[model samples]
Structures are given as structure tokens and as C-alpha cells.
Target: MTGSPALSSRIAELEAELAELRAEQAREADGAMLKVLLDDIEKRHAVERRLHRAEEWLHLAEEAGRVSAYTFDFATGTLDWSPSTLALYGFPLDEQPTLGRWLAAIHPADRPAVQAIADHALQHHGDVDHRFRIVGPGGWRWIEDRGRIVRNEDGSAARLVGINIDVTELVELERRASLDGERLRLALAAGRNACWDWDLVTNQVTWDQQLGVLAGVADFGGDFDSFWALVHDEDKPRVRAALDRALATGSDYRVEFRMVREDGSIRWTFTQAKVVQDADGKPVRLVGIDSDITETKLAHLALNESRLFLVSVLGASPDCIKVIEPDGTISFMNSNGQLLMDIADFEAIRGKRWVDLWPAEAAPLLEHALSEAVAGRRSRFDAACPTAAGTPKWWDVSVAPITAEDGTVERILSISRDVTDRKDADDQLQLLNAELHHRIKNTLATVQALARATLRSHSDPAQFEAAFSSRLESLGKTYGLLRSGPQAATLSELVEAELGPFGGRSDALAIGGPEVLLSSNAAVSVGMILHELTTNASKYGALASPGGKLAVDWTIEDGNVALSWREHCGDPVAPAAPASDGGFGSKLIDRLTRQLDGKVTRVWSDDGLSLTCRFRQSAD
Candidate 1:
């Protein structure tokens, strides 16, 4: 080829320089290899580029795989790590790897196991595939290390080269998978269930063989018609409608229905189904489970019936009946019980502590009752409490424990009967009985006094009997007035009891007095005094003969009763002394008058005997 002038001149200059280089190389050594030196330079540059590319690929592989290569040199007792390996331990890239840092980075709990693996590998020259943990500035990470130990001829570990791969996510996934498996196992073991799959578009149903066992049949048909035939006739249409609605709304389907078995016995089942939808939210399939729930259903029904029966019994009771929880809270109260308690809304007081519901005055009693019940015993108390409407009541409350099958106290029962009326009646009865007893005792003491006086006055048996019997009769008449439902008797009533047998005003006997009520003591004493006078008058006074006149008058003055008695005997009167007996009658009069806390005075005149007495009447 012909060269241009500039090209020719440049080639001539290169040849001239090449001739001088050849002469200089001949003076040196190996002048014949100088002609291939340019080709060798080209090859050397290509090798350098390939080495740079390879290093870039290695660094990328380490970073992308979350991996780092490690090397441990036994001879130097030093460890070497790439930049990624140092970063994995939370160390700066400029930090050099050291044996101490490497060993310290291992988790304390995992260190011993790792050491054992290393020791075994050193002695046996074995391959290692271990998983462990390491902690750094970055919390902790799980690492799966796989490596082979290079050994010397004597089987001592010369070096260990391995890759550390982060496996935290894989470990977590495995743990979750294990837990899910355990849950599935527990669900299957909890009950007898028959699983099914339904293809909505194909109208096909696939059921497990357990369905036949539930239906009391030897074999079950796999088609939808066979499964539908097992459903009770009354429930089929409802079941179909429910399924349709569930699919329409893409919701879960739950139903409880009856299944007639082959033996004509009824069984109950609960079914729950889930719909599988496509990407566009259209239903594609249904997966369901049919669980045998006959036992549970029957028990629930029986429990409900028992509860109803108990409710009826409590409703029929006239007393307040309450059920308390173990925590001493009111749990249930019958409708009638709420009415008796005057609680318009039971919810207002529900869950309130039973002790808190009582008045402070009755809290101690209520607390004691509750403690007794909690200890599995019975206690009773009678206390006064007001209702919710503030009506006062006396309640006879009986608290008993309700026990569970395990013999533990499960609840408390409180039955309160209103006893306000009964309590009042009992108090009144006690008071009447006490008063009657007291009066009877006093009467006996008075009788002793009458008998003693009669004995001293009349030594003869016949005379003594006549006087004592008459005195006893007068005392009896006095009590008759006192016993008439009042605590005291009228003064007039006491006087008439003793004087009625003698005569009225028609027979020349006069009696007048303002109405006055006297206590039992005053009545007894006054009656005795009047009787003594009457006995004397009838035997020796005006009543002893015809044409004799007798009169008695009384008045209340300054809280005291003043009485006057007079008589006209048709003959002139003698001295003011007893004419019917010795001084015994006068002495008896003196003694009874002293008992009245007053005095009796007598004045004799040509007319008759004038006797008057003054004393205070006791109200007690």
C-alpha cells in the first residue's frame, strides 16, 4: 500500500529510532525479545482489568447474601475478616480483626457449645454446620455457619474458613409454623368434626368419611345431594337460604341444625363455613366443619330448665330471696323479692356488695352472716332496716351457703322474712305477762297481812275464817278492775267492789266522788281499809239495824284523795272506838291507814260516826 507523505515521514522517524534502540539493546542483554515487548504489555493490561472486575463481584456477593467470610489462623492465633464481616459485628471497616474481639462477640450462652464444636473439629478434622447467636451494637442475630477445618499432618486445626449467614427470619418462620401445627392438632382433638369442601360453580360437595360416622351410616355420598339428604327436612330450606346469604355477602356461615340418623334418632350438629373468594371478590368455594354437639346442647337445655324452675320457686315465695356471688355481690333477686325490698330497678343495686347495702347500724350483723355463709355454714339474725323506699322493717334473716359439686362454697342464699308485726306482738305479750305476775305477787303479800290481822283479832276458828274470807273477797274484786287491760283502776270502781254488797243510796247509804284512777298498790290498800270499815258497820255500825243511815264522800285535792264516811245509828253514839270487837279493830284501822301514807280521824257525836282519811294516790 502507498503511504501518504506525512505517514512516510513518521515511519522513517520510527525506523531511525528503532535502529538506535536495537543498537542500545544489543549492548545490553536479550535484544531478540525486544521485538515481542509490545504484545506482552497488551496481555499484562488485560490481566489487571480482569482482577479488578473479580474483586467487585466478590464484594457484591458478600453484601447481597448478608454473608461475610471469616478465617482463623491457628499458627498466628489471629482471625481475619472481610469488610462485610467486620460490619456484621458492628465494627468500623477500618478495624482489624482480632482473636479476642471474635471470641467476645459470641453470645455467652452459645460460647461453650461453639468452643466444643471447634475443639472436636481440631482433634478430628471434621466439617462444621452450626447455628448460634452473636451480639453487637446491632441487637443480636442468628447465624448459620458452614465450614471445613484444614488440618496439619498430625490432625491439628491449621485454619478455619467459613461464611456467616443471617438466618433470623428463617428461624422465626419455623417457630410460627410449629405453633400453627400444634394449634391444628389441639383443634382436631377437641371434638369429633367432619370437614367439607364445596365448589360453588360446579355445585359439587366433597366430605370426609367421618360424615358417615356422624350420620350413623356405613358410607356417605360425596355429592351435594347426599349431604343435603342428611339434614332434617324442616331445616333444609333454612340452611340453603343461609348458605346463599353467606355467599352473597361473602361472610361466614354458622348454623345449628338437627340431623336424623339411620336409626331414626335425632342428633344435633353445629356447622361453620368460610367462603374463599377470587381476586375480584367473587365466591369460588366453601370450606366448612360439622361438629357433633348433641351432648352440649342437651346439657344446656337441661340447665335452662333448672334455672326456670328455681326462678319460679323464688317468685312464689313471700319473703325476700337473694343470690349472692362468691365476692359477696348481689347476683340475682326474684321479682317478688325486689318488690318486698322496694327496689324499683334491680340493676341499680346489682353487683353492689351485700354489706354495703345494709345500714351502718346493721353492718356488723350482716358481715357476720356473710362470713358464716362463706365458711359453708348457716347464720341467722334479726335486725331493723329500712327499705329502698325508707319503710322501717324488722327482718328475720337466714343466710345459708350454696355449695358446688366439689364441696366448695359457690354462692350465698339470703332469705329475709318481715317480722315487724310479730315482734311488736311479742313485746306487748311480754309486758302483759310481767304486769300480771307482779300484781299476783303483791296480792299474796296483802293476803298475808289480812290473814294475820284476822288471826290476831279473832282467836276462834269460825270468827277468824269469816273475817279473813271476807277480806280476801274484797281484795279479789279490786284486782278484777285492775286486770281490765289498763295499768290502773278508777277509785270509784275500787270503792264499789267493797261497798256494793252492803247497800246503795236507796238503803240510806250515800256515796259520791270525782272519777279518779288509782294504781294497783293504792287500790289494794284502800280496798282493805274500806272493807274493815264496812265489816264493822254491817256488824256494829248503822247497817246493823233499821233506821240507821250511812254516807261516804271523796275528793281529789292537791294530787291527794280525801275520803269521808259518816253514819247515823238511830241511838246516841258512845266513844270513837270499835264497838264490834276489842281494840283489835282499831289497831287494824291504824295499821292500814299508816300503810296509805296518811291518817284517818274519827269524831263521835249525837248523830253517828264521822270518819275521814286523806292520802296521795300512786300512779305507778
Candidate 2:
């Protein structure tokens, strides 16, 4: 095909023309294919335009829903804020906010954080999620922003797409809740209260450490239902009502109930709660407090019961019961107690002295009784009691001790019964018993003499028996002397009785001691022991010699009663007289000493035998 010149020229020219035509045809075909491709591309771009428009509408819708979008071109140092973004910045929708102006709207405190977050996002080409405060036309608003770095093909951050939401209301609500939480924390710390948080959506509960202790549940192991189960059956309904009311109307809730502790103990508690809601007014959380009041309630109830019992017992008593302080104040009086003195004015009697209410004759009796009672005696015989109305009354007064915390006798509780009606009968009975005892003792003495006389006349046994009869007569005489009254005889009377056998010369035996009166027990033991000792001495020691003389002396030493009997002007006592077995008289002396819880000592001296006995000076 590449041949000759003429032929070649003609052919070449023709070929060149053909080549041109082929090239043109090829160009046309290529142009046609390109046109078709361009048409298809334009159709696709038109569809994408429609989608892009729909996406823009979606973004606008989101912005209308309290949201705004923003973009920052860091390379160009430019910012583009949507209408919502402008409005969020408190600027008109048409207003254009520079990057610096937009940043200025952020709270100064949060600006650094926002910049740091942006810088990090730009540097790492990473997503950023942040919240900051901004001052706007309305007030300080909280803006929660989220954005992603738009990276260029070279992996460098080119732009930032972010959305800012006005979370001012939510943040304010959170702040209020935080304040409430702080207040509740203070209250709990002061009162040792417990707290609870309930999540309605999750149906779960969180309990403070103390609430777990109150409910007796493990702090971390209980659910809301589990905690509710611990409420006492009687209080569950009320607690439930409180919760329901709070949830229904978002009102404050308050209820008091009992809870069953883990250890099966019951506790009274007061609870209060408030409901928290979302922006849509849907309940989100319940915050409450619980306080234990069991101990206080129980103590109050017990005190009430005790007071009632005390009042009842004191009131119902037939005898007059009075509480009188050491200072002579009548702190309390039963009905009978007030009536006893004809004192209707309780106020006047309150601070008045009890002694001031006594009649002249009864004053002595009252003083004596009070003195005896103050000496730790439980009771005393009051011959007479003076009344506030000038009446003379007799009472068998008994004073019981009421000690205070400091170990002092704080009050004297007196119980007195009116014995006026029975006084005559009691006196007559006492006289009759004393007469009967005296008569019987005299008759026994006479009978003993008669029996001795009969035995002696019948056999000579009377001679030995007469000695015993004489001693019995002496004892009868002593008894008659003491039965004269409530007072027991003195030591002088006792010694005189025992020495009567010695006749007129009994003066040879001297006796001395305190003038104090002897109690019945002391009088009896002393009389028996002295009588036996005198009889034994007459038979074997001092009185056995004509020149013998005895001296008896008694005294009180410390709290003990001491008595000594010594013999003089007689044969010196023999130490080796062969410690004979004790006779009945010696044994009697020992027995009497034991009965008196006393000590007896016998000293054998060159002069004679000296005997001393000591006994505790008590009424026993």
C-alpha cells in the first residue's frame, strides 16, 4: 500500500484523504460516545443534587429541633454558622459570626477546654465531643457540641462539622439537683439519715450506705423490689402511696413507716422523696431520705406507761403517800396524803415544810419519827401527828429511802395510815398482854415454891430445890419490871435483881455503868449471864469467903458495850485449880456470850478472879 510516486502521489493523496476521513469519523464517534457519557453523568449528578437537597432539608429539620450546625475551615481561618447557630449565639439569622466572634461567646472558663478539644481534633483528625457554656440574649446557656475533623486526601484536617445544642434548661435542672443533693448530704450528716435514688426507666434503685444498714441488706446486692420488700407490711401501702403521688404529680413525698431489719429487728423511720423529670416531663429519678426514730418512740412510750403506772399506784393507795425532799419540800402527794392534813391547796403545800403543818403536841412526835427515819430506820411509832388544819392525828409512819444518782437520799417517801380508830383497841390489847405475862410469871414463881415445899416436906429435896426457886423468883421480878412499858430496864436493875440473894450487905458489891437504856435482847442476855456468874461465885469463889467483896462496872467503848466484874478481899485465884470442866453456870455464860456475838475473858489475879464481857451495842 506504500508504493510509487505518481501512483504513490495519487494513492498517498487518496490515502491521506482517507486517513483524514477515518480520523474525522473516529473523532465523531468518540465525540458521540463522550456526549452519551456526559448525558449519563448529568443524570446521575441530577439525582445526587436531589439527594443533597434532601440531606440539607434533614439538617435544617435537625437545626429546627433545638439544634444548630457549624463548620470551621482551619486552613482558610473561616467559619460558617447556620441560621440556628447564629440564633444560638444571640445574633440575627442573617448575621455572619466570625470564628473569633463565635469563640468569644463561649464562657471564658470553658474557652480553653473548647480550644484544646478543637486542637486535638485537628491534630489527630479525630472526632470531638464537648460541652461548654455560652452567654446569649436569654441568659447563660449550655452548649453541647459534637464534631468530626474533615480530613483532606493528604490526611490533614481541612474543616470541622459540629452541632451545638442549647442545653441550658437541662444544665440548670442538673444544677438544682446538685444543690438539692448537697443540702440532703448536709442534713444526712447532721442527723445520720439514709438516702435512696430510684431510676424509673431501669426499675433499679441505689441506696446510701446507711440505708442498707437500716434495711439490713447488703449495700450493693439489693434491687428496688428487694428494698421495698423490707418495709413492714403495715407501712408498705403508705410508702407506696407516697411514691405514686410523687410520680403522678412530681410533688414532694413524705411518709413514716417501720422497716424490718436484716436481723429481724423492727425500726421506725421517716422518709421523704422528690421526683426528677426529663425535659419532656417524664419521670427520670426519685431521690429520698430515711431517718431512724425507733429508739426515741419506744423510750417515749415506756416513759408514758411508767408515769401512768406510778400515778395509778400512788393514787389508789389507802394510806397517804408523800414524796418529801430533804429540804422539807413536799414534791408530790397522793390524794390521801393531801387530805390527811386538810390541805386542798396543792400549790401552797408544794414548797412548805412538813413540820410547819404539825400541831404543837404532834410536833415532837414528828421530829422524833423523822429523826429516827433519817437514822436509816424504816419505821417509827408516831404518838401524834400535827395536821395543817390544827387536828391531832396519830400515825404509824414509815419512811422509805429514795436515793439519787449522786448516792444521796434525795427524797423520803412516807406512807401513813390513820390509826386513830384502832389506837384504843391496840392500847387495851397491849395492857392486857402485859398484865397476862406478869400474872403468869408470878403464878409460876408461886407454883415453884409450892412444889418445892411439898417435895421438901415429903423428902428434904426442897432444901436444894429452894435455891432454884429463889433464882426463878428473881427472874420473874426482873420481867415484871421491864413489862412496865416500852422501855427495857437499865443495867442497875438487872444487877440489883441478881444480887438480891446477898441481902442487905449486897452493898458489898459495887455496880456502875452508863445510864443508857438496854434493848430487850441486851437486858435478857445480861441478866441471865450475870445471874449465873453471881450464883457460881457465891458457891465457889468470892462469896465463899467472909471477907470477899465484888465490884461490877460497865461502859460503852467505841460501838461496843463493855462490862467487868472483879472480886477483891478474897483468897487469891489459883491458876492450877485444875481447869475443871465448865459447870452449867459457866456453860450458860458461854452460850449467852455467843448469842450476843460478844467476847468474854476471865483473868485470875492475885487479888481475885476478874471477868470482862463485851458486846456490840446494837438492838439485836
Best of the candidates, TM-score: 1
Candidate achieving the largest lDDT: 1
**Residues 494-539 of candidate 1: C-alpha lDDT, one tens digit per residue:** 7677565443234767878998777777776676567667655655
lDDT of 1: 0.76
Predicted candidate 2: what Cα RMSD to the true structure?
23.1
Question: Weakest 10 consecutive residues, lDDT, candidate 2?
Answer: 1-10
Off by over 4 Å in 2: 1-65, 73-77, 91-96, 149-159, 196-205, 213-218, 223-289, 301-305, 308-316, 319-620
RMSD of each: 17.7, 23.1
Could you tell me every candidate's TM-score relative to the true structure? 0.46, 0.39
| Candidate 2 TM-score versus the reference | 0.39
